[model samples]
Target: MQIDPSATSHPALPFEYDVCVDRLPDIVTRETESAVRSGAIPTFVSTDGKTWVSYVDLFINMGQGRRLRDPASAFFVSPEAMRRISYSSDQIDAAGPDLSERNKVTLAGAKRIAATLAQLRKDLPPWPYDLRVPWSEDFDFPLAAFIKAGQLDAYPSGRCWWVRSVEATKLLPIGESFDDPASPWFVGPHGRADHAEVVRLSAAHRRHWPEIYGPALTPRVR
Candidate 1:
């Protein structure tokens, strides 16, 4: 189904906040490594050669004060960990996989948004100075998933996938510190967020691409 443009002005209810984390255990890595040696992909690697395994734990505060323990809601594997299990091509291929028919539909909806963003970028200027670095790459799946689940909100426009308005009280604990190579939290400086800046830049994206964005706004989660 196509997204309606007029809905842009209609605001959804505020999102609730809670915390999230990465919960892969040591044993899982050992088992995974054994499998990798036996021909599986060894995506997990320690930054410092001495350490054989890498794991991460993050603190994510969903809008609500609660913290989650479920892997889906609280914990996420590091991209590096994921790489150990599969290749980038495979990961990209698995992006929108077979699932409940509803999920398939959701995936299609997301693809539409992705396409819109791709086109919008061609016409827009770089994100504002403060946001330029982090906004360089296209939005990632985790963030997109959060937006799809109504955990986050974005304003799209003819020019870009602008404005990312997250719940104020929420704090997402992205594991892997920038300083630690082995840590899953090591998203480069250009990968992190300056919340306020993202919001302001998103507004700019909206202003520029209003028309294309108009037909693309849909409920976060059907």
Candidate 2:
């Protein structure tokens, strides 16, 4: 599988390949792209089963300013359950020893996400999936869960708590040269669509599936 050179424009943000492959709906793609360009930040917008939850791959360009890199997460926001937890009056430490330093979180953002999830609990008849950051907002721990832990800070209010989870990281595929097998993104006998290494590639070389390579996505047995 190879990316269609003729079918793409410069992927300014990650997951732009998602838009090209029809895994992400056109409406959601357009809306997310618009918000990212405007600097609101890539967000977990919505989903209709056509694709997973939509988010942006944000980056700070050298001179252009804060913008999304070309790409979106390939993993679907897991359609799982969430438990509501409240921090004790005596705040606990937030940052878990396991959490990484590649990213940071804010107390306010943590609170906000917690509140959002709480509201979603009340609003949605059934909890959809775990509320995930647009990207690796915090792969390891959900920000709200660690609020009382003092992982972020003791700030009471007027601050947004944001966590960069190290557990999961989704990035925009920056199409670097990968014609060589040495390249992590190289397409070869093992180039399954869902391969973690393949997903990391900035390009979706899906021009030929089942023929040159097996289906990146498993085809319906039927």
lDDT by candidate, in order shown: 0.31, 0.28
- Model 2 regions lying over 4 Å from their true place: 1-23, 40-99, 102-112, 119-222
Candidate 1: tens digits of C-alpha lDDT, residues 20-117? 11224454434444544665321222233222321211111111111122355322343433212111111112233554443344334334433434
Q: Which stretches of candidate 1 lie over 4 Å from their true place?
A: 1-140, 157-187, 191-222
Worst 10 residues of 1 by lDDT: 12-21
Residues 44-148 of candidate 2: C-alpha lDDT, one tens digit per residue: 322332222122121111111111232452322222211112222232134446432211232333333333333322321111111222213444223334554
Per-candidate TM-scores read 0.19, 0.20
What is the Å distance of residue 173 in model 1 from its true position?
A: 4.1
lDDT of 2 at 68: 25
